[model samples]
Target: MTELVATTPGLLPLPDWAKGELSDLKGHQKSDLIDGTEGEAVTEAYDRVRAEELDWQTEAGLDRVVGGQARWDDNIAHPLSMADAVDTRGIVRYYDNNNFYREPVVVGELTATGDVAAELDATAEALDDGAGDLQAVLPGPYSLADLATDEQYGDEAAFLDAVADFLVDEVEQFPDVATLFLLEPSLVENPPEAGIDERAGAAIDRVATATEADVVCHTYWGAVPEKPYAHLMDADLDAVGFDFVSDHEANLYNITEYGTTDDIALGLVDGQNTRVEGVETVRERVEWVGEQIPAQSFDTTYLTANTELFYLPVNRAREKLAVLARAAAGEEEVTA
Candidate 1:
């Protein structure tokens, strides 16, 4: 059987303590909390949060673990907002969830203000060998463009290109990253207007080529429009991920037309759903995807949750994560 690595697209839900710590830091700076820790630090917030998450992921038998995205303030766009060219606006609802993020606005030419990888770099150093390789996540250029308002760039095409260029540099700063998950929920959630598919494809390719690590473009939320779906294969991605829970049939059906020589990461676990799925049920879905798209068509695979685990309660999210590991490993006789 093929070994499918189990991982997430990062942006993990804050553990109980981390949530409170973040609350205190809210409308404040992370720098203020550092000195105020005095030595105790209540686990120093994110440092502790990421450490705990790493410990849990290692214990759960995952093959790859994200750095917990502890430093991210708003759905992967937080770090980008810190740049001088981008303006941070009022809180806005992210997708269909109650969670909110400060909107990123393009006010001028986007530039990298600080090292985005610093926290993850420290987290990686703190992890034991048992913790799997650290995979970094970023909001896809097209999606980031859609999520943010463009005040400088007049046209959508230019804005998309600029965001992609900025992300190419941002992702390159991720030190020792093994895999990069370019999260693009907007592509499937709110498809772009017609005729921009080519630019979208280029946007994806730009960020992908910035680093040597295998880049995977993961789309979620619903069936992506056929226009953009058809264009994905032409992009320079090492793998393409599909949200099996949202509309697996359409995702599978569409991929066959613009098939790839790359690997296909299938998001089998439902991140938004509260109900836990058994290992066997998830395994069956994984098998179904394989039959739909022959194993020979792709080089390797990844089995992951359909979206960020933030939608579910922390405990429930972690439980589902373990199940993903079990299903990917083809384990049987799992217990609740």
Candidate 2:
């Protein structure tokens, strides 16, 4: 008998205590908060919380377990650890919504490989010994290019290629450790108006071909252009992630076009907002998407559009996700 698999969107929450600890560590240098917790105490706290989050996911019957991103200063810096050119700015902003602020460092060059691979290795080692569904998250090449300063890289294309090369190296090194390599292109919301560039496509292709692991390209926070979608379809990727919580109509259109060939990670859970969605609401959205493609053509995985770890209060965030889990199990209905 064939087994049916459902993915629940997961949250990345920082415990209240952890936040307090971070605050204490920041004392006078609040700006350096994001890059401040790289030492022993912070690492230990992160490990404990990450393990707890994974356990929560397992108990909730979630198909995949993210490392909870507990150790990351921010999403962008988490993957850029191997790079030598980047430096900590000691201060970070949410970049959107005029919400909470984050202390993330700026990337100095595209040629360096940050500590992403090491972080993934550590995270993989921390999960249950036989866990088969572990995933590592990364920022997309184009987005990294956009975030880099003009002083860092004279030619954006060349710099992007360098970052892509490093990504390919990282992907190839940990083929057996993770189930999926998730790439988040936050900048895709504002890509170059002309079209998808060759260098970007090539970088994605390189990583896809090098890793036996499934590659999922995720674009959230806004709409992705047709040219990039076209380019992604031609690349050697296994799936594409779309945020239903954000621009559903545009994402739906993209899914309709390429869902049959590529696996789809449906982001039903809102990552940035505090409101919890009911099962019925999520189910309706899933059902609508299911109608567009065969069940096997896509896999529904719940993910907050961005990291909930940074935005929501920890306890409230967990309670909200608890509702999502119940919904995924068909135990509750989304209230109007």
Candidate 3:
């Protein structure tokens, strides 16, 4: 029988305590500081927040654990924005949402900066081996390219390939993780241009092969158009995730018509909303997907948020995680 796992796609909301701590630390800073004592204090805050986030996942009975991305202020493009080869331009609206992130623009030859690996390593050390089946998250190559402007590499395909290679180098430095979730929202938010899908899939596949961990290419905000969906299926990913909570009728149709990998993720929880869903409601969503593509067909199924949980209040995000765990465990009697 297939196993049901409850996990998040990463970028969870920060707890109130962490926010206060960060505020206090910022008060002590001089000149936009992130070095010396100021930097150390921020790192300490992040470590504490990550440890608590892991505890939240474990206490909620989630099978897979993520570090909650407590240090990410720029959302999915954080690592690339930190790279020396890249420079960020004016803030842009993140997809169709109110949230915004600095759009990364390539200025020089793209290269790995090891920033992501350092953060992951720090998180792992903070978790102290307590994060069971730990996972790491990264911005998918196609989305990274889509979200970024290419000033160095003139050709679109060349720029995408460079971004993929940069990610591969970054992934190579990561501490051993069970799974890697590549958030590729642009695939759904901004559909690939004509004849770009195959190259996009190839770039993703190249990055997937860079690490030993199982890779999941998770797209959200909307469903992938049919042509891109077919090309996405060619990527060497352990599972491909789709958002089933918002505007997802097309997602169901795509899976039923074109099929998916044996291992898959269904984003049934609304990560951006404040309203919490009951376990039964989540179960019904899973059952609905099962009706379209029988549950027996997949080896492993991940129940996750439709997108990052950072948009919601901290308490609500925690409640959502608990709800996901309950649904995955088939426990209908949920409290608050």
Identify the candidate with maximal lDDT.
3
| Per-model TM-score on C-alpha atoms | 0.92, 0.80, 0.94
The reply for model 3, stretches above 4 Å from the true place, is 23-38, 128-130
Going through the candidates in the order shown, the clash numbers are: 0, 19, 0
* Model 1 C-alpha RMSD to native: 2.9
Tens digits of lDDT, candidate 3, 97-165: 898988888899987988778777876776645446878999999998988889999999899899999
Task: Please provide, for model 2 over 23-89, each residue's C-alpha lDDT reduced to its tens digit, 9 standing for 90 to 100.
Answer: 5654644444435335555556677787777776665545556767666555554455435555544
Roughly what TM-score does model 1 have, to 2 decimal places? 0.92
Off by over 4 Å in 1: 27-43
**What is the C-alpha lDDT profile of model 1 across 1-336, one tens digit per residue?**
455888887777778877776676653655643332222353466678888888878877787887787666677676667677777779999988788898988899887654457765876787798778878788898888888999998998998888888888787677887788999888887787777787898889888988888888999987678888777677889888889898877887787766764687888888888898888988898788778767455566888889988778888888888898888777874565
lDDT values, one for every candidate: 0.79, 0.58, 0.85
Clashes by residue pair, model 1: none
Global lDDT of model 2 = 0.58
